[model samples]
Target chain A: MMNKKTAPVGVFDSGVGGLTVAREISRQLPDENIVYFGDTARVPYGSKSQNTIIRFSEQIIRFLKTKEVKAIVIACNTASALALDAVKDEFDIPILGVVIPGARAAVEATKNRKVGVVGTEATVQSGMYTKVIQGMNPEITVIEKACPLFVPLVEEGFKEHQVTEEVIEYYLESMRSTDIDAMILGCTHYPLLRSKIRAYMGDKIQIVNPAYETAMDLKCLLEENDMANDGTEGQHSNYSFYVSDAAEKFRKFANTVMPFDVPITNVVNIEGY
Target chain B: MMNKKTAPVGVFDSGVGGLTVAREISRQLPDENIVYFGDTARVPYGSKSQNTIIRFSEQIIRFLKTKEVKAIVIACNTASALALDAVKDEFDIPILGVVIPGARAAVEATKNRKVGVVGTEATVQSGMYTKVIQGMNPEITVIEKACPLFVPLVEEGFKEHQVTEEVIEYYLESMRSTDIDAMILGCTHYPLLRSKIRAYMGDKIQIVNPAYETAMDLKCLLEENDMANDGTEGQHSNYSFYVSDAAEKFRKFANTVMPFDVPITNVVNIEGY
Candidate 1:
C-alpha cells in the first residue's frame, strides 16, 4: 500500500483552464506528486447550472479517490464556486476550493473596501465571491460581472489578439469606471488573459489570481494535517495528466503553459464514474 | 399508435443553435409536428475529438428515437460533419446532416467556382464541406476557416454588438480578399450574425445558410416518401423542446429566437442513454 504521506494530490477542473492552478501547485509544492484531471468533454462549467456542476464535481472526486489521493483541489473557479460545498464533506480527505482563497486575497488587497470580480455566467450568478468577501468584511462592496467570452477567447488561442483586447474593453467598461481597488480574475481561464485584462484595467487596480492563493492554502492544509511529502521515502515526485476527451489537444495546450513537459496524457471515460 | 405520416420530425444539435434549423423547418413544413433536442450539457462540440462527438451524437439520437421521431436532422454543423456517417446507418430511420445541403447550396450559388466555409473547429477539420463540394465539381475550390469564437459570441447575446463586428472582420479578413463568390454560414448559430457578416463580406459575395437548404431537402424527402403530414387526422401540429441540462436557460434562449413561444421545456439525462 502507498503511504498516505507519499500519495499524490488530486486536482480537477472542467477543462484545461485549471492547468493554471495545477501549475501553481507544482511551483509551490515541488516535492508532492500530482494527478490532474480535465473534463474536456463537457468543459466551460461556468455557464452550466448548480446541480450539473455539483454532479460533475462529485464524479471527478470519486474518480480521484480511486487514485488514492491524499488531498484534492477544485481548480476550476466555476466548479469551486458551485460544487465545493456539496462535495467537500462527501470525501474524508482534505479538499480545498479556490473561491475562499480568492475571496480572502481580494479582501486583503482592496484599499477602497470595494472589489471587482469577473467570471463565467454561472460563477457570477452563484454570487460565491461576493458572498464570501462580504461574509469576511461586511463593509467591503463586491462588484460582480460575468464575462462569458473570456474562456472561449482563451481556448480559441486569442489571448493576445487585438479582438481580445476589444472584448476586454467591452466587458470591463463599467467595472473600469468604478472605484474598486482590486479585481479578481475569477475564472481559471482569465489568468491566461491576464496581460490583456491588466492592460485594460490599468495599474491602479490590483489583479488577484485565485490559482496562486489556492496553492498557498493547499500547502498550509498539508502542513497542518502532517501529510506533506518530505522526500525521505525515496519516492521521486511525478506528474500525471488525465482528461475525459482526446489527450492530444489537452497535451498540446498543457505543454505550452505547464512548468514541465507533458509527454504522455491518459483518457478516461468520466461519464462511467 | 402514431401514424407514420403524423410522426414528428426530430432535430438535434449540440445546443440551442439548432433552433435556426427548427425555425426554418416550421416555416417550410407548416403541418408537421417537431421534436427538438439540445445537448446543452455537452455543448459546443466544435473543439472535441471525432470519437467523442460521435458518442454524444449517438446518445442524443437514441434519446430522440424514444420520442418516436420519423426522421432525424443533424442540425449542429460539428455533429453533422463528424458523427453523421458513423450513426446514420445504425438507425432504421433516415438521418440527414446539414453538411451536404450546405455544400450543395454553396456549389450552386458560386459562379466563380470558388466557395468559402466557416464553422466550428471540428466541422472545418472534418473537411466534409470541402470534400462534398470538390466531389461535385473537381474544378471548384473550397476555402475553409474555423470561426470557433462565433458560437460563443452569439450565445453571449453579442449578435448586434460592435465587438462581434470586429471579431467578424478578424476571422474573415483573408476570405474577404479572396474571389470566392459565395460564403456558407456553415454553422447553425451563424444565422444570428448574418447582418454583421453580410456587412463585412459586402455585396459582391452571396451568403448561403444551411438551415434553409436542409429544410428544403427535408421537404423533398417527406414528399418522396409520402410521409408529409396533411393535418387530415385532426392531430394539431405541436412542437416540443428537450435539453440535457437545466431547462430554464434553454427556455429563455428559445423564446427569444424561436418563431413560437417555448411554453415548457424538459430536461433529460443524456448520459443515461
Candidate 2:
C-alpha cells in the first residue's frame, strides 16, 4: 500500500467554475490524488453576503477535513475574497486562495502596469484585487468591473452565444477605456467567458486566469512542505466529488467542464455535518 | 394595534429580481405589510439543479414560516418552475408560484395567439410554461428562448446600458423571427429589462410580467380568504426583511425596487432549516 502521505488534496467551489482550477491542478500534478466538492445546490456565492459565504465555506472545509486533505484550495473567487481569512484561522491545514495567485500573475503579465479586473459584484466591491495588486506593486493602476452576469451566462452554457458576447462587451466596456494591458478574471466562471471577452477586448489585453496559476502555486506549496505524492508505479490518482445539493447536476457539469470524468456524490445536507 | 391576521405577506427570490414582484405587491396592496427574503447568499437559482433549487426554496420557505407569514409568494421564476409543487406540499399556507400566474397572463395578453418566452435555462427547460399555457389555451403557440443572462444583468443593475441594449437585441432576435405577438418576461428579474425588451420586440409584442399578475392574485386571495389588511383610517403597515446573505446589499436593492424604504435583517445561517 502507498504511504498515507499521499492523501488527496481537497478543493471546493460553489459550482463548476472550480473545475477550471481543478483541471489545472490535475494536469500539473498527475501523481497526487484530488478530491473536489461543488456546492451545486446553492451556487453563485458571488452575490451572497460575507457572513453567509463564510458559514458555507466553514461547512465545506469541515467536510474536506474529514477526508484528511493535505491542504485546501478555495477555488471560488467569492469564497477566496470573503471567507479565506476566517478559514485560515479556524483550520490548521494550509489553505490557498485564488486571488493572490491571480494577482501575482497579473502583475507579471502586465507590461503597461495598468490592469483591469472582472468578477462578481461581491468580489469586485471587496476591492480584493486593488489591495492585492497595490500591495505587491504600488505603481500599478487597477480598474475593476463587476461582470455579475458572466457567471449565469457560463452556468447556462452560453459559452458561445451572441448575447453572451454582447453582455461581455457591456461588462468590459469600462475596462477598455482605461487602456489596461491585462485583465484578471476575478471570478472562477469568468475564464469560460474568455473567448467572448477576448474577442470584444481585442488581443492587446492579456487575460490572467488564476486557476492555472493557483495550480502552479499548489504544486510549489506541496514540494516546499514535502507533501508531494511519491512515485507509486501502477497506482493511478482519482478524483471524487461531493456537493451540498444535487449530485446529478454536478456529475453532468463535471463531464462538461473537465476533460476527464470523475465520480460525484451529493450530500444534500451540509448543515448535518 | 391592528389584528394579528393582517400580518405581512412573505415573499422571496434567489436575489433582488423578486424586488420587481415585491414592488408590484406593495403598489397593489398599499396598506398590506410585506416581509421579503432575497437569498442573496445563493442567488441565480436558474442555473442550479432541480433538487438543489428545491432545497433552497424549502429553506427560504421555512425561514418565512418563522416570520408567521399569512401567505407565501415565490417571486422567482426558477423556484416556480422547479420547486413550486414540492413547496406547496411542504407548507399548508396559501403558497403562490409565479409560473402559472405569469403563464395565465401571457395567454390573456397575446393578441395573435403567438407568444414568445424568455427566462433562465432551468425555467425554459422545465416546460412549465408550455404545460401551464396549454392547459389554459391549447391552441396558443408558445415560442420559448432561455435568456439566461438577463437575471445577472438585472442584479448587476445594468438595466439601461448600451451593452444591456445589445444583449437584449441578441437574446430577443430569436423572437423576432417567430413574429411573437406577446413575450412573457418569464423570470422575475426580467421585467426590469422590459424597456429594452419592448424596444427590441417592438409595440406589437405585448410584454407579460408575472410579478404584476402575482401581486394581483395575492390581493384577490387575501380578500377572498378574509386576510386582507384593513385600509381603514388610522391603519399603517410595516415590512421586515430577512436575507440569507448580505443585509446591506439587500437593503440597497430594496430601496431601489420598493416605493419606500423597509427594515432589513440578515439571518446568518438559515440554510437546511
Candidate 3:
C-alpha cells in the first residue's frame, strides 16, 4: 500500500510556464509538498505530434514516479489536451489534467455562455476544451484560437513589453468582435501575460486561469479520496523542483514570475525514462 | 574513391530557418543536388548545451551521410559555432560551417575595422565569429549580441509587423553606440528580416549575410577538391528535405520562407541515428 499523507504531489509543464501551476498549488495547499518538473530541453510541446507529446509526457511521468508522488498533475495544456486520455488509465495513482478544470471554470464564469479559448496550436486543435465545455452545457458556444507566438513572447520575458502587447493584439484582434463573456488562458504560459491579454480584451471580459482551478480540483480530489496530508496547518515542507535542462535559467525565470525565490532547482535527464 | 561529381550536398539546420540556407545554395549552385534536414522536434538550438548540440549535429550528419552526400554544410549558426570543430575531423568528406564565411564577409565589408554580430544565444555565446574575425584582423573591433526572440518572430511570419520592428529595435538598441561599419547576419533566419534590420541599422552600416558567402564557399570547396557536380549545367537533381517532426507544417513554413514550394518534406527519427 502507498503512503499518501506525506508523499509529494507531482506537477509538470513543458518548461517554466508550469511554475504558475506549482505556485498556485503551493498557495492553495501550503502544507503539502510539491515536486515540479519542467522539460526545458524539448519544450514548446504545442508544435509536436500527439504521439511525440505522449511519449514526452510518459517519460516525465515515469521520472515523477521515481519521486513517489501521491498524484500527478498535467500542467501543460498541450500535453493534457493531447496526451492525458491516452495515459490516464496506465497509472495507479490519481492523474489530473488542467483542461477539465479550466473548462469547468469557464462554464461557471461565463454568464452569456459565449466563451473564447486561447492556447497553443496543439491545445486548440485538440478540441478538448470545446468537447468538455459542450458536454457540460449543451448551448454554450466556444471560440478557440491558437496563439503560437504567445508562448515564445512569455518565455522571452516580455510580459508587459510593447512587443508582447503587439503580438497579443495581432493574435486576439478578431476575438474582440466575437463578444465572448469569458476567455480561458488555456496554455500554462498565457497566465504570465494575463495583464496584457486582459488589457487587449477589455475589462468587460473575464479571464480564466487553469492553474488556479486545477489546484482547487486537486485539493478537492485529495479530500474526496481521503488522501489529504494530515499534518498541521502551518507544517513546513520543502518543495523540490526539477528541469530537463538549464536549472539556473529556470530558477531565475521562476523567481521573476513567482513571489518567492526558488532556492534549489535540479537538472535531470528526462530522455532516459 | 568517392563519386563526388554526381552526388548530392548535405545541409542541416535546427528547423525551417535552414531552408533559407538551402534556397541560397540552390540560387548559387543550381545544378547540384541537395539534402536538407531540419530538427524541428529539438529546435531553437540556440539555448541548448554544447554537448547536446554536437550530439544532434552528429546524428544529423550521420543521417545525411546515408543520403550519399559528397559534402556537408552546417547551415545553422548555433550548430556550426558549437559543434563543427568537434565533428570536422570525424568525417572524411568536405565539411563546412556558416561561421567562417560569415566572419570573412564581415571582415571584408567593414571599412573602419569595427563589426557587429547578431545571432542566437548559443551561436553568439560561442564567440566563434569574434575569434575568427579577430584571427583574420587582430585590430578589428567585434561586438556580438544574441537576439533570442528574432527566430520566433520570423517563424511567426512577422517580417514587416510592428512587433517585429519593436523586437528588432529592442535587441539592436545598444549596438547603435558601437559605431560598427558593418553588421553580420550570423543566423540563417535573420536574412528574412533584412529589410527591417537594414532600416533600423541605417544605410551606412552594411549588412552581411552568411548564407551567400557560405554557398559561395561551398562552390569554391567543391571545385578545389575536384568534387563539383560537373554534369551538364541543366542536369536535374531532386532536392530531398527531411525534418525530425511535423512534415506538413515544415512544408508550409518552407513555402513561406523560401521562394518555391516544398512539394514533399519527409520526417525522420533523428534520435535513432
Candidate 4:
C-alpha cells in the first residue's frame, strides 16, 4: 500500500480556468500526485453570492476528501476569497487558497505603496485582496477593477489576438492612470493573457500571478509540515482530472490551457455529493 | 384570484441577459404580466452538457408554474437550442423557444438563400439554426460562427465603445467574406449590441434579432389561442424578477439592458426545486 505521504493533493475550481493554478503546482511539485475537480456545472463563481460560493466549496471539499487527498487548494479565486474562511477548520489537513499568498507576494513586490488588482467582478467586490493587503501594511493603497471579459477571451482562444489586446487596453487603461508599480492578475484566466497585459501595461508595472505564489506557498507548507512526497520514485506523475459537466468539453479546453496534452477526464455528478 | 388569461408569462434564461427577450415580450404584449427568472448561479448554459441544461430548464419551469404563469418562454438561446425539445411536450402550457422562430424569420428574410448565424459556442455547436433553416429549405446555405466574446463585451458595458466595435469587426470579418444576406443574433444578449453589430455588418446584410422575432411569435400565439389579456382593466403591468444568485448584480444589469427601471428581484435557491 502507498504511504499516506504519497497521497494525492486536491485542487478545486469553479471551472477549467483554474488549470493554470494546477499547472503551476504540478510544475513545482512533480513528485506529488494531483486530483483536480472543476465545477463546470456551476461556473464563473465570480458572479455568484458569497453564500452560494461557500456552499459549493464545502460540497467540493467533501467530494475531494473522499478521494484521499493529503491537502486541499482552493484554486478558484472567488472561492479563495469568500469560502476559504468558513471551511478551513472543517478538515484536519492544511488548506491553502490563492488570495492570501497573492496578497502577500504583491506587498513584497511593490516598490511603491500603491498596488492594482484586476479580477472577476465577485472577487473584486468581496474586497478580500484589499483587506489582506491593508492588514499586512496599514498604509498600502489598493485599487481593484473587475475585468470580466478576460475569462471569456481566454476561453475563446483569443489570448494574443488583436481583439484581445484591444479589450485588455480597454480594461487596464484606468489601472495605468494610478501610477501603480505592481498589478495582481487576480483571476487565474488573466495569466494566460499575461503577454498581452504586459505589453499593454509596459515594463514598469510588475504583473503578480497568484498561481505561482500559491504554488510556492504550497511547497513551503508541505516541507515545513513533513508532508512532502520525498520517497516517491522517478515515475512520471499521473494527474486525474474531473469535471461536473461535459467531460468532452472539459477535455478539449484542458488541451488548450494545460502545459501537456490533457488525459481523459471523468465527469462526476458533483451535485450528488 | 387572477384570470387565467390575465396571469403573467414566465420568461427564463441562465442570467439577466434574458431580460432582453423579456423586454421585447413586454414591448409587443403591453397588457400581459411577466415573471422572469435569471439563473445567475449557473449561467452561460452554452458550456454545460445537454443533461444538465435540460435538468436546469425543468427546475426553472417547475418554479415558473408555481408563479401562476400562463406560458413559458425560453428566452435564452442556449436553453432554446438545447433544452426546449426535452420539456416542451411535458408541459401543458404554451411553451415557445427562441430558436425555431429565429430560424423561420431568417429563412423568410434571406433573398440569396444564404444565411449566417452568430452566437455563443454552445448555440453554434448545437447546429439547431442550421438544421431548422436547411429543414425548411434544403437549397438554402447556413453558416454558423460562435462569437463568444459578444456576451461578455456587452456585460462589461462596452456596447458602444470603440473596443467593442473592434471585437465585433474581428468576429464578423469571416462572415463578411461570405455572400450571406441575413445574420441571426443567435444569443439573446446579442441584441444589446445590435446597433454596433448592424453598423459593422452594413445595411445590405440584415441582422435578425431573435428577441424581436420571439416577441412576434409570442404575440401571435397569445392571439391565436385567445390567451391575450384583452378585457383586463386599465392598470400598469407588473414585472417580477427572480435570480438564483446575487439580486443586486442582476438588478444593476437589468437596468442597463431593459428600457424600464428594474423591479425587485428575489434570489431563489433553484437547486431546491
Candidate 5:
C-alpha cells in the first residue's frame, strides 16, 4: 500500500485549462507528486447539462482513485460548480473544488462590496460563486456574466489578439459600467486571457484567480489532515499527465505555460472508467 | 424490418449545427421521414484527433442504425473529413459525407480556378478539401483556412453580432486578398453566418454551402438506390430528434431554425455504445 502522506494528489479538468490549477499546486506543494487528467475527448463541459457534467465528473473521480491519490481537486469551473457536491462524499479521500476558494478570494478582494464573475454558461447558470459568496456574507452584491467565447479564444491561441480584445469588449462592456472593485477569473481558462481581461477592465478592478486561492486552500487542507508529503523522499517531484485525447496537443500547450517541462503524457480512454 | 421505400434517412452531426443540413434535406425531400442525432454531449469534434473522431463517428453510426433508417448522412464537415472513409465500408447502408459534394460544388463554381475553404482546424489540417478538389480538377488552386471561432459564435447566438464580424474578418482577411472566386463554408455552422460572411467577402465571391449540395446528393442517392420514400403514407413526415445531452436546448434551437417543428426530442447516452 502507498503511504497516505506521500501518495500523489490527483487533479482533473475537462481539458488542458485545468493545467493552471495543477501549476499552482506544483508551485505551492513542491514535494508532492501530482497525477493530472485532462478529459480532452469530451471537453468544454461548460455547454453540457448538469446531469452530464455530474456523470463525467464521477467517472473522472473513479479513474483518479485508481491512481492511489491522497486527495483530489476538481479544477474545471463547470465541473466544480455542477459535480463537486454530488460526488464529494462518495469517495473516502478528501475532495476539493475551485469554486469556494475563488469565491472566498473574491469576497476578500472586493472593497466596494460588489464582485464580478466571468465564467462558462454552466458555471454562470449554476450561480455557484454568487451562492457561495453570499452564503459567506449577504451584503456583497455579485455580478455574474457568462463569457462563452473566452475558452475557445484562449484554446485557439488568441489570448492577446486584436480579435480577442474585440470579443472581450463585446462581453464585458456592460459589466464595466458597474462599480465592482474585484472580478474573479471564474473559469480556469480565464487566467490564460488575464492580460487581455485586465487591460479591458482596467487596474482598479482587482483580478482574482482561483488557482492561487485554491492552492492556498489545498495547503491548509493538507496541514489540517497531516497529509503533507515530507521532503525526505526526494527534492524532485514526479508529475504524470493523462488525457482522454490529444496527448501531443496537451504536452505542447503544457510546456508553453507550465512552470516545469512535461516530458511524457499518457492518453487514457476515460470513457471506460 | 422496415420497408426500404418508407424508412427514414439518418442525419447526424456533432451538434445542432447539422440542423442546417437536416433543414435542407427536409426542403429537398419533403416526403422522406428523417431521424437526426446530434452528439451534443461530445460536440465540436473539430479540435479532437482523427482516431477519436473516427471512434465517435462509429458510435453515432451504430446508434443511428438502431433507428431503422435507410441511409446515413455525416452532416458535420470535420467528421466527414476524418471519419467517413474509415466507417463507410463497415456499415451495409449507403453512407454519404458532406466533403465530396461540397468539393464538387466548389470545383464547378470557381471560374478563376482559385477556390477558398473555411472550416474547423481539423478539417483544414486534414487537407481533405484540397485533396478532393485537386483530384477532381488538377488545375484548381485550393486555399484552406481554419476559423475555429465560428462554431462557438453561432452556438452563442452571435451570428449577426459585431464581434462575429470581427472574428470573420480576423480569419478571412488573408483569403480575401487572394483571387479566389468561390469560398466553401466548410463547416455546417458557417451557413448560419451566411449574411455576415457574404457581406465581408463581398458580392462577387460566391459562397457555397455544402448542406444544400449534400441534401441534393442525398436526393440523388435515394433515387439511385431505389430507397426513395413514396408519398402514399401522408404529406406530414415524422422527424425524430436525438442528442447525447441537452435535449431541451436542441429542441429549442431546432424549432427556431428547422423547416418543421421539433415537438419531441429523445436524449440517448451515446457513450453506452
Candidate 6:
C-alpha cells in the first residue's frame, strides 16, 4: 500500500491557473511526483454549465487515470462546484476539489457571520458557497459575486493594473456594500489578482484561498492512505505539466507563476474530451 | 454555382468576441445565413503559440466544413495570425481570415505610413502584421503591442471601467510614444474595448477593424464567385452557434454582442477532430 504513496498525484485544471494549486500541493507534499494537465485547448470552464463542466471533468479524470495517479485533484473551482460528485462517483480513486476545501477553510477563518464569495459565473450561479457554508454553520450569511473577468484577466497576465483594479472594484462593489467580514477567492485565478482584490476588499476582510487548504488536505489524504513518498532529505521531485493546447504558452506561464520551473508538454487535444 | 450562394457563411472564434465580427458580417450580408462556432470552452487563445493556434483553427474549420459552408471566416485574430495558411490549405472551399482584410484596410486607412497593431500575445508574437504589411508596402512602418488583458476585461464586462482604462493606458503607453497613424484592433476581443482604446490613442488615430473589412471582403468574395445568398428581401437571416463547451455562456455572449439572438448547441468535441 505504501508503494502507492509514490504513484504520483494527478491534478488537472482548465488552464495554467491550477499552477497555484499545484504550487501549494508541491509545498505541502514535497516528495511526491505530480502530473498536471491543463486543458489549455478548452479552458475557462467557469462560464460553462454543470452538464458540460461535468462531462469535461469526466474526460480529464479518465485521461489522468491513464497516468496511473493514486488520487485526483480537481484544481478548478468551477469544476469542483459543478462536477465534483459526478467525478467522485465515476472514479474509484480518492478525488478532491478546490471548493469544499476552500469552503471549509472559509468557514474556519470567518469570525463574523457574514462571508463573501467571488469567483467565475458558474461558481456564483451554483450557490455552492452558500450551500457549503450553510451546511457547516446554518446561521452564517453568504454573499457571492461572479467576477467573470478575473480568470481571463489573470490568464492574460494582468496581475496588477489600474484597469484590473477598477474592474475588481466594479465587480466587488456589491460585496463591499455588504457587511461581510471574510471573502473567499472562489476561483484559483482570483488569487493571481490578489493585490487588486485585497485592495478592493480592504484589510478587514479575511480572504480564504483553497489552494493552501487543498494542499494541506492532500497531505492528510496521502498520510491516511499510506501513500506518502519515501522520506529523503533534499531529494529531487519531478513535476510534469500537460496542456491540451499551447504547450509553449503554458511553459511560459509556468515560468511566470511558479518559483521552480517544470517542463510543460502538449499531448491531449481536449476538444473531444 | 449560384446555388452555392444559398449556403451559409461560417464564422468561428474562441468566444463571443467573434460576435463583433459576426454582427458585422450579418449587417453587410443580410441575405446570408451565418453558422458561427465560438470555442468558448477554450477561449483566450491570445497567449498560446503558433502551432497550437494552427491546430485549433484547423479543427474548427473541419467542424464548420461539415455544415457545408460555402466560405469560412476566421473571426479570431490569434488564429488568423497563426493559422490562416494551414486553414486555407486544409479546406478546398474558400476561406477568409480577418488579418488580410484588416491589413488591407489599415494600409488604405494609414496616411502617415505608420501602422500599429494591438492584439493578444500569440497574434503579436507571430509578427503577422509586420509580414502582411511588409508584403504589401515595405515602406509602411508597423508597431505592435500585445494587449493581453483587454480580452478578459471585455469578457468580464469592464470595458469602461477606470481600472480597465488604466490597464489599457499602461499597455498602450508604448504605442502612444510612436507615430502610428492607424491602429488595427487585431484581436476580435479588442473591438469590445475600442472606446477605451480610442480614448487612449485620441481621435487622430484611425482604428481599422478587420471584422468590418472581413464583412466587406466576404461580400466581395460572394459577388465574385456568384455564391452570394439570394434569399427573399425582408427575410430574417438565422445564425446557429456551436461550441466545444459552454453553450449557455456562448448564448449569453451572443445575446450581449450580436444584433440578433443566437441559439447555441454544444455538438462537437474538438479532441476527436
Candidate No. with top lDDT: 5
For model 3, what is the error of residue A104's alpha carbon versus the real structure, in angstroms, after optimal superposition? 0.3
For model 2 the local lDDT of residue B243 reads: 76
At residue A62, what lDDT does model 5 achieve?
A: 89
Give model 1's docking category.
high
lDDT string, candidate 5, B139-185, tens digits: 99999999999999898878877888888898999999999999999
Model 6 regions lying over 4 Å from their true place: A193-202, A230-236, A255-266, A271-273, B231-238, B256-271
Compute the DockQ of candidate 1.
0.84
Ranking by DockQ: 5, 1, 4, 3, 2, 6
Candidate 5's residue-wise lDDT over A2-119, tens digit each?
A: 8887889999999999999999998998988999999999999999999999999988988999999999999999999998999887778899999999999998998889999999
CA deviation > 4 Å runs, candidate 4: A1-3, A89-92, A223-226, A232-237, A256-261, B1-3, B223-226, B233-236, B256-261
Per-candidate Cα RMSD to the true structure, in Å, reads 1.3, 3.1, 2.4, 2.5, 1.3, 2.9
- Which residue pairs does candidate 4 place in steric collision? none
Runs off by more than 4 Å, candidate 3:
A232-235, A257-263, B89-93, B232-235, B256-261
Worst 10 residues of 4 chain B by lDDT: B226-235
Off by over 4 Å in 5: none
lDDT of 1 by residue, B121-148 (tens): 8889989899989989888899999998
TM-score of 6: 0.91
Q: What are the TM values for chain B, all candidates?
A: 0.98, 0.94, 0.96, 0.94, 0.98, 0.95
lDDT of 6: 0.83
Worst 10 residues of 5 chain B by lDDT: B229-238
| lDDT values for all models | 0.91, 0.83, 0.89, 0.88, 0.92, 0.83
